[model samples]
Target chain A: MIWNEEYETMPRADLRALQLERLQETVERVYARVPYYRQKMEEAGVTPADIKGLDDLRRLPFTTKEDLRQNYPFGLFTVPLDRVVRVHASSGTTGKPTVVGYTKRDIRTWAELMSRTLAAAGVRRGDVVQNAYGYGLFTGGLGAHYGAENLGATVVPISGGQTKRQIQIMRDFGSTVLLSTPSYALNIADVMADLGVDPQKDLKLRVGVFGAEPWSENMREEIERRLGIKAIDIYGLSEVIGPGVAAECLEAQNGLHIFEDHFIPEIVDPTTLEPVADGEAGELVFTTITKEAFPVIRYRTKDICRLITEPCVCGRSFVRMPKITGRTDDMLIIRGVNVFPSQVEHVLMGIKGVEPHYQIVVDRQGTMDTMEVQVEVSEAVFSDEIKHLERLAQQIQRDIKDLLGVSCTVRLVEPKSIQRSEGKAKRVIDKRQL
Target chain B: MQLEQIAIFLENKAGRLAEITQILAEHGINIRAMSLADTADFGILRLIVNDTDRACQVLRDAGFTVGRTEVVVVAVPDRPGGLASVLNTLTEAELNVEYMYAFSQKSGDTGLLIFRIEDLDRARSVLQAAGHRLLSGEEVSAL
Candidate 1:
C-alpha cells in the first residue's frame, strides 16, 4: 500500500486544488448528516456554500474535545449505528469519555494509513513487531496491532504489564520492531540488562515506533543508545483515526507528514478559529476527508505544532508538522506565565541527580499563584541526611527558576510516595480554581 | 578519612526494602551489608554494595529515588565501646554526630560506622590525630 502518489508529491497548485475539492464535499456532508454540526453552523450563521475553499475554513465553527463529549457516544457520528464497524474512546481526565466511531471503510482506511505510517519507519512484512500499548478500550494497542498485520508483519500483541514476561518474549520470539510509549520503551531497555540481555546486542529490535505520550529529543537519543534501534515518532488520536495520522520516516527529519489525502490538516488559533502563519506555532486542526462513520470538520486537536512547507529529506511532498510542544488547553497560566509540563521535563532531565517523576502543584495564596514542584528523590539518594535533602531541594528550585523564569518551591519526597498511572502520566495538579 | 556509604531513602511502606534489593539482584549487583533507620513515614536505607555506580543507576531508572556520600570508613575494635573509643574524641572536639550505623555481620574483625561531622577535613584530622584509622573508598568497597 503506497501513499496517493499524486497527493504525496503534489505541487502546491495541485495540492491546494485537491484540498478545495475535498473541503467542499466535507462541508455539505457534515451539514447534512450530523445534526450537532448542522446546529453549530446555523448558530454561527454560516452555510455550506460559505466554505468555498481553504480560505473559508474560518467561516465554519471549530469543534473541540469538549464538543465531542457534550455530544457523547454516537452523537457526533455521521453514519448510522449499523454501518459503524468500530469505536474507540479516550479516557478523559475530567469527565465522560470522548468517543470516536468508524465504518468498515473508515477502519480499512485507518489500517492502510497505519501500514504506510509503519512502513515509513521501515516496519515491513515478516518482521516481528511487539505491540506494547494496552489493548481493549485504549486505541494504542489494537491500532498498532492491525497496522503491523496490515503490512503482513508478525505482531506480538504483548499488551502492558508483566514486565518480566514482556522481556522474555522480546528475546524468545525475536521481535524486531518495538511499539510503545517512550517512557515504557526506556523502562524495558533498563530491564533488559537485568535479565542477562543486552539491549544493544541481544535484541533483534531494528526499529522502535514510540508514541501516545510526548517525549524530548534527548529522550529519543537515550532510547537509541539503550535499544540499538532507530526510534521514530508516530502521531494520531482516536478521533482522527488512531495511530496512523502521520509518522516520521527513516531520516528522522523535521516533522511528521500529514497523510493529508485521508486527513486534512490545519493550524488554527484555538480561541478565534483563525489560521496562523505557516511557520508559527498554533493549535492543530483536522477534518476527516475519507472517513465514513465520524467525519469531524475543523476539529481542534489542542496539540501545539507548526506546519512546515519546506521539502523533507524523505522526499515526500506531504505537509509536515513539528513535534507537538504541548497542548494548548493543558497549558497552566501561573501568575500570567505560561508553563508546560514538557518544558519542566526537559529541565529536569538536564539536571544531575534529579528524577523525572515529579508533580507540579498550583495553588493560590493571598491572590498570588505559588507553584510547587515535588521531585521524588531516588530511594538511594533519599537515604541521605536531612541537610543534604534540603540542599538538593534548593538546587532544584534554582534550576526550575533559571529554566522557567518562575520561582517555584521545590520539595523532595521519598520514593514510592507518588502515584503512577497506566495511561498518560498526570504530572500536574492545579488548584487555581480558575 | 570520609567513609563511603550507600544511602537509600524509602517511603513509609511495606516491601520497599525488598523492591530495591530486587533491582539490585537484576543488575547482578550484590548487597554485602546494609542498615535501615526509619521515622514515622519514611526510612533511610544505607548499604554497602560491590558496585555503587551500577546499583545507583538501576535503582534510579526504576523510579526509586537515591544518592551516595563519602564519610568516615574505618575498622574498629570488634568489642563494645570500640565505636565509643573513636567517637569520644570527636565528642570532645565539639562535633555533632548526625547519624551512625554499622555495615553487617559479614564484616568480621572490622565493624564499620558512617558518621556526619561539622567539618570533613577537620573530622579526618581529629580522627587521625586520635590514632583512629580512616579507611579509603577502595577498602570500604572491598568489604
Candidate 2:
C-alpha cells in the first residue's frame, strides 16, 4: 500500500542526504527571495552556504508564528503571485490570521504527501473517500481532498458539518475512508445512532483519518468502537503544509510517521530551544525541505511531542512522532476550532454592562468538547426581568460565535465570583483529560 | 399603587433558596409574598418584602445580584372569577403584564395580586378607572 515505495522506504542515510540537499536549496532560495528570513539568518550570522550538513539546521535562525504574523499574507512566499496556486490560513493570536501559500508544484507535492499519508492508513485505489474536513481558508478540507483524489480513491469532497447527511452519504456511497477532525467523527457516529444506522450493519466504513486537534488515546478507542473503523491519527498544521506532513501507519497505529522526505522534524526543549534526545518529549520544530512557495526553516511548532527514531512496522524509514500531548501556550481547540482566552476577553470587553472578569471552562461531554464561558455579572447588567438578562447572554454568545466560530454557553454569575489571582488570573479550566 | 420589589439571582443549587431566606430572616426582614422563575442553570427570586432597601442591601452584601423593580398591587375579591375579571380589564386597556403573583390577605376576604407592568402610570389610571382597588406601598408592607 505504499504510495511511493522508493522514497518512503529510502534508507536513513539516503533520506538525510536528500534532506540536506533540499535544505540548502530552501535556505538559498529564501535568502535570495524573502527579506525576512534573510534578515533572521543574517542576524544569526549564518549564510545559506553555512548549511552543509543536516546538523547545521540549528545554526539558521528559528522561524515562529510571530514571524508568520509579522509577515502577514504573503510576506514569506518565495514565489511570485502567478506561481502560487493555493493559499490557506489559521487563526492567529490576535484578529489577523497567519497565512501560507503554495505553488503549483507545491500543490502536487502536497497531494503526493497526502497520498503517502492515506496509503499508510491502508487507503488504496477504488475505496470511496468521504472527506469531511472543512473546506475554506483552512487547509484541512482541500488538503485531504487532493490527497484522496491523488491516491486514486473516489473522492466525495464533502467538507465538515451536516452530521446526519455525512452518515447518510457514508451509508449510501459505500465509503471506506473517512477524513475529518476526530471530534466530528464522534459527532457523525452519535447522529448515526440517533438515526438507527448502526455503523457495523448500515455502513461500509473501514478506516478514518482524524486530525487538526489533539485527542487522547481514550478518544481514539471511543471513536474506533463507535464508528467500527480503524481510527488513524494524522498530524499537520497550516504552517507545516497542512495534514499531509505526518500520518499513523495502520500497521503500527502506535505513532504518526513524519513524511521526512518533505519535511525535516526536530524536537527541541521549548524553554532552552536545544534539541532534545530522541524518544524524549519536547516541542516539535519543522523545516519544510521540499516546499517551494512557502519554505520555512526550523519553524517552532509549539506542539509538544516526542520523536521515535525506531523504524515503524509499516517498513517506512520515516521517524514517527506520537500524538501531541500539550501546547506551550494557552490555545484551546474547541470542536477543532482554535480559541484563545484573550479572544473571549476581547469579546467580553467590547460588550458593556458586564465585568471583564471571565473564566473559560472546557470539558468533554459524551465525546464532544463543550466550552462554557463564565462571566461575572455586574450591577449594570443585572435586570429584574428575565428577558433582558437573557438578551444579554444571547449578545455575548452571538459575538463570541461570530468571532471565534465556535458555539459556547455563556453563564453570568454573581460579581467577583471568578477568582482573581495575584500574578495572573487563571483564565482557563481545561477538564478534558487529553 | 406602586410597590418596590427586590429580585435576587439564584444559582440552581440546593439550599440556595434557604440561604437567601436565612439571610433575610437573620436581618429580621418580613417577606410579604414571593415567586420564583427558574431555568436549567439559574433562577430569579422576586420578593415583595416589608423593607425593600434593607432586603436588597443584605442580599447585595451576601454576593447576590439583586435589583429593585416597581410592581403594582391590586386587591381582588377572593373568588375564582375575580382574578379573571381583573385580567379582562387589563386586556381591554391594552396593558402588558410582565409577571404576576398572588397571596390571600390574613383578615379580609380578598387577595393581594402583584403585577409587573411596563407603564406603571398608565396601568394605575386604567385600573382605577375600571373601579379596581389598588394597594399602596404601605398597605402592602403592613398587610
Look at candidate 2 and give me any clashing residue pairs.
Answer: none
Candidate 2 scores an iRMS of 1.2
Q: Which candidate is the best by lDDT?
A: 2
lDDT (tens digit, per residue) of candidate 1 on A1-434: 24345556777788778878877887888899988999999999999988777878778888887788788878988878999878887644233456888888887888888788888888888899899887876678888888889899998998876777888999889999999877678778767767778866777889999887666787788889888988998898887888889888877545888887777888877677678887988889998778888888888888989898788877777888878887866656454334667667766777676778888998866335689887777643453676666667777788767656568987666655667889978888977542
Taking the candidates in order, what DockQ does each have?
Answer: 0.28, 0.48
Error of 2 at B137 (Å): 3.9
Off by over 4 Å in 1: A1-6, A331-434, B1-143
Residues A47-99, candidate 2: write the lDDT tens digits: 99999899999898899988998999899999998899889988887756889
Query: What value does DockQ give for candidate 2?
Result: 0.48
Most TM-score-accurate candidate: 2
